[model samples]
Target: MKDVLMNERHMLSRRKMLGGAGAISAAVAAASVSKVAMAALPEPVIQTKPDTMPPLVPNTGRPYNPVVTLNGWTLPWRMNNGVKEFHLVAEPVVREMSPGFKAHLWGYNGQSPGPTIEVVEGDRVRLFVTNKLGELTSIHWHGQRLPNGMDGVTGLNQPGIPPGKTYVYEFVARRPGTFMYHPHADEMVQMAMGMMGFWITHPKGKHPLIDEVDRDFCFLLNAYDIDPGAATPKIMTMLDFNLWSWNSRIFPGIDPLVVRHMDKVRIRVGNLTMTNHPIHLHGHEFLITGTDGGPTPKSTRQYEVTADIAVGQMRQMDFLADEEGDWAFHCHKSHHTMNAMGHDVPTMIGVDHRGVAKQITKLIPDYMVMGERGMKDMTEMEMPLPDNTAAMMAGTGPFGAVGMGGMFSVVKVRKDQKRGDYSDPGWYQHPPGTVAYEFTGALPDPARFKADVSPGPGSMPSMAKPAQDVEVKVRKPAGGHSGH
Candidate 1:
C-alpha cells in the first residue's frame, strides 16, 4: 500500500514536470512520503555558526528577494520535480549564545532558534519533520492559513509526532508574510529549551504592498533562564528569564545590521518569548510596514522610532539608513539588555562598603564588592565569571566598553558599504568636527528653571512668584521629650 502511494507521488511529480499541474488535486500530495527507495527525504542542511549568514536566494523555485537572519541562517530546500521540499530534524544541540557561553537546547537542524525557512508565495511546500529527540514534538506553523488537519496542534489537529519518527506537512504558501514555527507539544519545556525558528514567504512578483529594500533582515526574540555555570535552561521559569536574546544570541554575539548609506532597509522582528519588547533603533525612524497577519495599509502607516512587539507577534519595520554612523539598536527594556544577571543581588548605590569589604575580605579573600557605584564599571573592570557564563554587560566600542549584553546590537550605516554586502564595515569614521568632543574649558553651573504655576483665581502671591529659598524655625516643645 505504501509503495503504491510512493509510485503515485512520483507519477504526479512527473506530471507536474510536464506542465500537467493544473489537473492535480491537493489531496494527491497530502499523504506522507512512502518508504520506497524513490521517496527518500531530502537531506537536511545544517549550520554551525552563530552569525548572520548571507541571504539565501532561491535558485530552483520562483524568484524572490531573500532575507538575512541575524545570528542565524536559512534552511536550504530541494525541489522535488516541482514542489519545494524541506526536512527539519528536531534534536538536542549546543548553541553558543555568546562567545563565552553555550546552552544545551533542543531545536531543528543544529542550533537553538533553528535555521529560518524561506519560501515563495503560491508555491507548494512539503516539510519532512523527523523527531530525533527523546520525546514527542510537533511544529505549529504560526499564523499560516492551511488545512485544519495540518495545523500541527498535537491533540486538536493531529497526534504528536512521536520520538524518532517522521511526520510530513503539506501546504501551499498562500500569503507573503513572516511567521514562526515551534513545537505545540510540550510547549513549556520544549519552547523554553529554545525549540523555535522563523519562516518567510516572499511575494513572487512586485506586490503593491511589499516594498523593495536593499537590506532585509529577520530574527526572533527569545529568552532563557539558565543559572551561572549551567548549560540548560530552567523550563519552569515563567516571568524571570535571566538571559534575553535575539535569535538565541546575546550582544557581542549578535551581528550588526550593516547597511549602505541612504539605502532603504527592512527589519523583521518576532517575539516568541513570554514578554513584550519595545524594540528601539537609534539614528533613524521607520514605518511599521508588515505584521504577522499581513502588511499594514499605506493609509494606516506611521513613522515610529520604536516598535513594541507583543508576545507571539511579528513586526517588520522599514527605514532609510541616512545616518552614517554606528547607532545603538536594542530593546527598550533595560533588564532585557543584561545577560546572566543576579536578580537577588541588592543594589549598592551610594553605599560605602570600603571598611566592611576589608573585614569581609579577611574571612573570604575572593569576596568582591560590586555595584558600589554602578554596574557599568563591571564592563571595564576585569572580573571573574562562572564557567560558561557571560558577563552581565559585555562588548567594547571604539572609545570604551559598550556596557551592553543581551538583546543589543548596532546598526552600522556606512557611506562605503556596497550593495549585497553584509560584512561589518568596522566603526564609522566621523569627519572633522563631527564627532562629539569634551569641553576642556572652565565648567559653569547648569542652568535651572523654576516650576511653572498655572494661573487661577484666588491664588497665593508666593505661588505666582518665582520659587525662593525659605527658612522656617520650629519651636521646641516645653516637655522636651528628646523627639521620642
Candidate 2:
C-alpha cells in the first residue's frame, strides 16, 4: 500500500514538473522521507568565528564568543571564492515550545525562526534555498538593501520558489546591522506558522559600540493562536492571539539571558507580530543603539527602561549588567504574558456556581465550576485538556508557581558567574534589610524620606506637581492589637 501511494505521488509530481517548473507537494515529499532519515542528516556546521576578518575586540571585560541563543544556534556557512555560501531548506518542523507542548510549524533548515545568519560587512553572500513545503514560497530579506531581482517577492521581484525547487539569492552584506527574513508568499499564513530567522552583519573593522558588547543575542518575536490542546497555530488570527513567543518559544522553556556582572550586553529584538511590543527590562536602563535601518547615531542615543519594537521592525538594545540579580525581561502588555487563554469563557468571578455545578455534576461526574473568586485557581488546576494542548498558564519557579506564560524570560546576572557559562544562576538572593518589610506599629516620620525632591541637572521635568504637606494616617486593624 505504501509503495502504491509513493508511486502515485511520483507520477503526480512528474506531471506537475512537465506542466511548468519542477513542483511537488510538501506533504508528498515529507511522506517520502521518514523521520529517521531527517534525523540522520548531519547537523549544519555553525561557524562562530569569522575567517576573513580580525577577531572582534573584547568588550565585556571577558572573552566573547558567539552570542549563545538560549534554545537556538547559528547557521554555518562555507567560503566559495571569497563569497560566503549558505544552504537553507524550507520544510515542516515540530518545535517544542516548552516541556509538554509542541507546535507544528514551517521553517528553514529544520528549526523555526530559522538559524541565525552571521556575516561580516562587505562580504558577498550566496544563499541557496530549497523549498520542501507543499506550497510555493519566497523569502523577503527584510530591511536588507539588496538588488531588486533578489528581493524574494513572489510576482513582484521574481517568481516564487515552487515546491521541490531551489533558488539562489546573492547579495553583498553592505550594511552592518540586524535584519530578518521570512516568506513573502502567503506571508500572513507562513509567517504566522513560524517562518522567520535573524540576519546579522558585523562591521568589517573596529566598531566601538557594536563590537564592545560582551554578549550579543538575537531572536524573533512571533505570536500564535493555538488553543490549549491544539498542535497547530490558527493562521487566520489577526489581532487576538494566545501564544506569544520569542523565537517560537515561551517563558520558562525559553532560555534565560545569562551574563556576568558588569558585562556589556546587546539584545537584538525583532518584532514580526501584528502588534508592537514594548519590551521592558527590569533592574537596568539601556540605550537603543541600532535599528533595522542601521546603527543609531550617538547623538540620538538615550537611556530607556523600556523600548517599543513595532511590527516588522527590529531594534538592538545595549546595557551593562552592573546589577547582580535575576531581572525580568518581557512584553509590557499583560495579556501578551499569558498563553492559550480562552477568549470565549465568561467571567466567573463573584459568582456562586456551586448549586448549578452540583446539578451538572449529577449528569457529568467530572464537571467542576471554576473562576469563582478569580482565575488564580485555574493556574493550579490540572484539567483534562486536548491531546496536545499547551498548558495556558504553566511553569513553577523556586518561590512558587510563576503564574505567567508566553513572552517572558529572566536575565540572570551574577558577580560570581563564570565567563561563557550559560547555565541558569537561579533566583536572585536579596540581602537582609534590602527586602521591603511592613512597619506594623506606627507610621514612619515623613521627614526621613524627604531628601532629594529637586530634579537633577539633565533630568526631565516632573509631569505632575508635587503634593504639599500631605497628612499620614495609619488605620488600626478591626481586631485591635492582634499580634505585631
Candidate 3:
C-alpha cells in the first residue's frame, strides 16, 4: 500500500512539474520518498565557523563583557510506539517574584524555564539525562530530527529513560535554527511543571545577509502555570491554562534584558506554554529566517514588527540592534503581562470573576445573561490596544511610523548626541502634519517631499504618550472568586 501511494505521488509530482505552475507540497514530496529511504539519508554537516558572523557582545556589568555560562537542562528521552519500558525523572524549580509576591514553581531541572544550550551549526549533541526527582520524565526534541532511537517516543521507537537510568541522545545538528526540548510524556502535567529549554544552533560560517552585524544574542519566550508550592500543575481546562510569562516571568518586573546598538541578535522564540504570543519588537523589523527546525525559503520569509509565535512552534529572527535602550519585550496577550490573574491589584486575588465582569461591562455596554448553555451568553470582549498605538498616534516621526503587533521588545542603539525633537527639514524629517497622512492611507511619494528632509542631525527620543489611559481594569464577574 505504501509503495502504491509513493508511485501515485511521484506520478502526480511529475505531472505538476511538467505543468510548471503550482508549488510542490511537502506532503506530496514525503509521499514520493519512501519513509525507509528518508531514514537512510545521511545528516547534513557544517564546515568552519562562518567568518561573516560577528562575535557575541558581553552585557553591561562588572566585567564589562563576559562569556557567561548559560545554564540548561537535559531531559530524559520519552519512548514512543506503545513500548513504555524506560523511565526518566527530573524535578525542576520555578519562582514568581513579580508584583512583590514570591511564589515557588515546579520544573524539570533547577529553573522555571530551563536554561539554553547554544551550539554552532553541525555540532553533534550528545544529550545525557540524570533523573533528580521521584517521578519519571523525558524530553522530546521539539523540532530537530534524529534517528529512531533518539526520537524520544515512549513506546514504538524506544523505551522511556527509567529513573536512575541514563539515556544518551546522540544526533547531528543538521540545521542552524532555534529548537526546543521538553517532556512529551504526560505533557499536561510535565510541561506545566516546566521541562523545557531553548536549543539554539548557529551556522558554521557567515551568510551574506548577517556578516556585517556586530553581535549575536538569543532570547526564548516561555509561560507557566503554578499551584503555589506544589510540584504538580493545577490544570484549569484541557486547553486554556491560566499561567503566563516570558523566559518564565512577566516583563519589566523581571530583570531588564539588554542589547547593545548595532549588534545583530539571533532571537530564538519558542512558545511552549499553550498560548500564541504576538511578539513585537520596538524600532526594527526582524528577518525571520527559520521556523521549527528547517530553513524557510526566501519567498515565504517574513520581515515584520509583529509576528505570532503559536504554541508548540518556534521562530528564528535575525535583527540588527540599530536602536538602543531598555527595550520592553513581552507577550502581546495582556494577561501574560501581569504577574498573575488580577495580579496588578494589591492582593493575590486569583481570577476575580466579579471584577472581570464589571470591567467588561464598561468596555462592552450591553450585558446579557445566558441562564443555561447557549451562544447567547457570548459577547465580543474588550482587547488591549496595540503597544505602539501611542507612538503611531504621536504622528509622523521615524519611530512613530512603525506600528506594533508582534511580541514587543526594544533595541537601544547608541547616538553621538541628541538632536532636538520635531520633524525639522534640515535633517531626516517628515513635513508637519505628515503623521496623519502616513497611517490613514498610502504613503506620499518621497520625490514630492523637499530635499531638505534628508538626514541632518541626530534627534532626541520622542517618548510616546498615549492619549487614552493605558491601565487595564480587572473586576470580578457577577459571580465571586469561587467561579474558578
Candidate 4:
C-alpha cells in the first residue's frame, strides 16, 4: 500500500536490491535452525562499518517518511504472504568508537545498539531472533502495546531464548510512535555490553497530527566504562562511564545532519544511558513534537533550545533550518564531551608545575608536566598515548582543530544541497560583516595593588588588603542620663 508518488524510482531500486528476501512460516521457526539449515531461515545480513546506510523506503507496505539512522542502519524485512518478516542474530561484535579505536561488545548483526526496525502502524510484523551468545537472552519492546505472550519479557511473558536457538515474534503495531528494544534478562550486563535498538511505527495514511518534514534523523544515546587503552567495557560500573557516545560512536566519528535551506527537520533521540542528557542545539529553537507516549497535543507544545532527556526516554524535536551555517548541536554536560582519558585528570591551573617537573625528572627521566594552564593544550600537544585509545579531542576545521569529542556534531544548513543527497557538504563559508573580528585598537592592562603588610623572608606575598589604623573619638551628651 506504499503508493507514494515521489521516490518511486529510488524505491524500485531499493526493492530490487532487497526484494529477494523471504523466510519460513511461523511453525518452522519453532525448531532451532542450525548453520547447515540456514536455507530454512531468513538470511542474516550483517553490517560492520560505522557509517550510516541509505534510508530504506517502504517497498511493500503503507508509505511513510523513512528515518536516517546516524552511524547505524535500518533492518531490512521480507514481505511474506502479507506478513513482514525480519531476522536478527545476536552475537559478539567489534564496534569502532572512533577511527582506529574499537570496543569488544555484544550486539545484533554486526554493530552495537543493533539495527533499527521500522514498520507501519497496521502491518502484521514478524521478527525472528537467533541467539548466538553464551547465555539466554530475550528482547522487551519498550513503549509498545502488544499481546502478553508477545511482550518478550523473560519468565514473565515467555521463556528466554537459549543459546543456539531461534524464536519468532508476530504482532501488529497497534500504536504509532517512537520506541526501543532491549533485553529484560541479564539486562544490566547485556545493556552495558551495548544491546539495544530503535523502533518507529509510522501512522497509516494522512494523520491529523503529523506533518511532512524534509529530513528525519534518529539515533540513541549510550555510554560505556572502558578504561584507557582497553577494548572492552566494564559492565559493573553504573555511575562513572568514561565514554558518552551517540549510537556507540564518539564525535568526529558521528555523521553530521545536513539539510537544505529553510527545510523542516525532525530529529528523534533516545537515551539508554543511566544519566540524563540536555540536548542543546545552536542557532535555532525547536518544538518537542513527540515522545514515547506519542504526538504531543498542539496546545502544550512550546519552542525550546534544549530538551533534557531522562533515562529510557525518547524526545522528538522539529524545527526549520532557516539559517545557513554550520551550527553546533551537542549535549550541554561539559564532561560528556570528553574521551576516556579526559576524566580523572587533576587540575593544575595557576600552579606552576615547573618546580615539580624538575624534581620528578631527576628520579624518572620520562616525567612530563601538563595542565599548568588548562586542558586546551592537550588538543594541540602531540602527547604519547597508549595503544587502542581515542584522542581527547579531534577534528580540524578551516580555522584549526575543533577542540571537542563525544556527543558533538554540526548541523550544516546550506542553500545548494540537492534533495535526498546526504553527502557531507564541507565547511560553511561565512559572509563578510557577519563574523566577529579582533579589534586593532590599543588596550590597557589590569591594575594590582601592593600590600603594606609583609611577612618574613622566603614567605609568599599576602594578597589581602592591609587594614587601616584609626583612632576612636567619643563626645559627651548634652543631657546626662547614665546616673538617672
lDDT of each: 0.84, 0.74, 0.46, 0.83
Sorted on lDDT, best first, the list reads 1, 4, 2, 3
- Best-fitting candidate, scored by TM-score: 1
Task: Report the lDDT of model 4 for residue 343.
Answer: 41
Q: Give the better candidate number (2 or 4) by TM-score.
A: 4
lDDT per residue (tens digit) for residues 1-484 in model 4: 1233223222221211122322234434554433222235556656787887768887666778999999888877777677777877788889999988899999988889898999989988878887879999998889998999878889999899987667877788988888999888899999999999999998887777677789999999999988878999999877778899999999888889988998999999999998899999999999999999998988889999999999999999999999999999999998788787734455577788888789999998877677788877777877777788788787777788888888898899999998887788999989889877899988888776658758558877769845986677544444332222
How many backbone clashes does every candidate have? 0, 3, 51, 0
Clashing pairs in 1: none
Candidate 2 wrong stretches, greater than 4 Å? 1-65, 208-211, 436-484
Off by over 4 Å in 4: 1-40, 362-366, 444-484
Roughly what TM-score does model 1 have, to 2 decimal places? 0.86
Residues 82-136, model 3: lDDT tens digits: 2111112255454442333333444533455554544545555555454445566
**lDDT, residue 248, model 3:** 51
* Candidate 1 displacement at residue 5 in angstroms: 26
Ten residues in sequence with the least summed lDDT for candidate 1: 9-18
Best by lDDT: 1
- RMSD values for the candidates in order, in angstroms, are 10.0, 12.5, 20.5, 12.0
Instruction: Give the TM-score of each candidate.
Output: 0.86, 0.77, 0.54, 0.84
Q: Which window of 10 residues has the lowest lDDT sum in candidate 3?
A: 43-52
Better of 2 and 3 by lDDT: 2
Off by over 4 Å in 1: 1-38, 445-484
